[model samples]
Target: MALPITDHIVAAVSKMVDDSQVEGYREPSHSDIEFYVSRAGLTDADPKAQGQTVGKAKRVRAILSWAIDNDQTAGGKLVESLIAKVRASGGFRDSSANFIGADVIARAVEAFDSEGYILSSDGALRPKNLESLMGRELTVALRDYARRAQKGSEDAALLSGTSKDLLEATAAHVIRTKYGSYPQQANFPALLGQAFIALEMATPEDPPSSTESPYRVMERGMYQSAVGVNRLRNKEGSGHGRPWVASLGVVEAEAAIELAGVIAGYMLDKLDNR
Candidate 1:
């Protein structure tokens, strides 16, 4: 169940939009507004309802959703702030309209463009999905990773040392925390391999009688992928100096960084559960 969105929530959100002062900030389109209202149970519950109606709660949720989705920088900040407040007040409910607070929604403002899944508020990283995978223990590390990845995603020139360095560092940190120690001088790829193996062992799975278990097989494949990422990082990443002519393109940088984030997130999450 979801917490009540309430008339007060609507008024508060309206104030935020008004205060933003972002030029040409879009208000919710009629269709979007209708959809939100209908989703919030503000419509007639009749199966054969002829017309749609909206209450303050539904209207507010729709507008906030539009703002958070479209004008991320300004709108997302406002939404995050509101969510923080509501959560502090112990107000969370079950329904999409009622579930106004989401970490990914707040974090999406830090992304470069809206095109990529690198910081999308949707897909595997929706707020509830993350909460299920992560607890308070891993919040700080996850947040740090998000901040670093945000910088890497934003840097089109790929010279800020944000992408690859952060990815590698994050993997090392997760490995160290999970295993209680990491090889003093192990490279990023090695650390990543060690981390995945540790996570696999931590989970209780059926022992294979002859052939390797699915867990071993999966981790092996992931280890190979990590090595490839490390190679990419070495050649065109934020590591040691290369020839002046060697340049890191945005695509390569993002792919490496995103892969690092995925690997780190998955391992850390598994460790937390174990």
Candidate 2:
């Protein structure tokens, strides 16, 4: 299948840095695109090569895919992060009129807020999705979470709560897909724990060890994250009138979100052929 956001990322990445706060910010050019694409391994030819052969769509897809899988890719930061940078830098302008600058990027992210795709953690270009691997009900719930907990929002508790809930919904969907039954009435962590068992990811009594498979390690981490998320949900999450007593932040909530996504993606992939 064609990769997400490839059609628009190049345009988004083409603008000059508009950080009014910082002097000497450089505007991006076709040269920057060429360099980034080549460095991302999306193109074999040097940036100084002849007429361009790799289309922007192809380059964007490859760069985003590399960024998702590798941590050190160039400028693969989340679109939101880029937006924040632009906003901090006083925002960029584009003569293209159809630009992908800060204002446009913000709108794009907001437009996709209730959809299946989201900006990844680093403010990179990939449009992340859970709907393809999950059901409509689960994805809708996740979309709600994504909208509320979006970056730059001050609702950290809501972010943690929504992420925890998203993890639960993912488990429910995966369990149904794997075992042909929906788990009803179970708490979030319990439902996830049972899903892990059904997948043979780990046993209930097992402790972390050096010998476990990577899948097992992932399951262990997901379960532990759920525990912390649930605790944060009760203590600091929305829907509670209690005074805030915890230290939940965007970073922690974002970590839970990323972890939930990784676990869900692994589980869904395992069920792909079955």
Candidate 3:
């Protein structure tokens, strides 16, 4: 099945190309078209001759359409790369036409924003669907942290800190849903345990005998993983005056974030069922 490449995204790219022609700005060259097509892992299905500018735009559209029809993940990546390229080039503006680029970027941002994603300050595309599962305040906070954590150039300290904050906000949201508020005085692991208990999931606090069930064991393991995440956060994460740990890297930070997300999602699932 074709992936859901929204019309808004497709139109944004096509419009940018078309608009670039008005100002006589450089359009994507033949090699550029070939590169993008190959990048998306798509074969050019439309080869009809047309005006230079319009032809390039049409070829881009054709390539993107073919990508959507054939490859799900690559299609999204292709769109993201195109948007990033335009954004990096400061929009589709000529030397005398500053507004063009801004206009194109705004349209692209709006298109992606509508699809539960955000264009970060550096123009990186990141997921922003926490609103469906959390309050606006928490969702915004988590989204910001997640974006920073996921950025290609983020430092290990920031990634570690943001990953920890993501879990903390998630736990707070789950706890707030069950009770009226979260315990501000609780430690990270304790707060995580409270969130699990609030959702009636197995926490480390559960008796050893009761944790023997496979599901319970898995939940307990999740709780332990969260604790480990907290430990990493304390040792290497930001928000402290501690010295930077050279050993912590992107891979470890990403793993921590993914683990936190998994545990948070599991707890939220329980909260939803309740």
Name the candidate that leads on TM-score: 3
> Where in model 1 is the C-alpha error above 4 Å?
1-167, 179-184, 201-210, 234-258
lDDT, residue 16, candidate 2: 28
Question: Candidate 2 has what TM-score?
Answer: 0.41
How many residue pairs collide in each prediction?
A: 5, 11, 0
Candidate 2 ranges with C-alpha deviation above 4 Å: 1-99, 103-164, 206-218, 234-246, 249-251
TM-score for each model: 0.40, 0.41, 0.46
Question: What digit string (tens of lDDT, one per residue) describes model 2 on residues 182-202?
Answer: 658887767877777766667
Which number leads on lDDT? 3
**Alpha-carbon lDDT of model 2:** 0.48
Tens-digit lDDT track of model 1 for 69-181 = 34434344434444344333332332333333443334332332222212233211222112222234334436545444544443221223233343454455566676655
Give the Cα error of residue 85 in candidate 3, in Å. 20
Candidate lDDT values, in order = 0.43, 0.48, 0.60
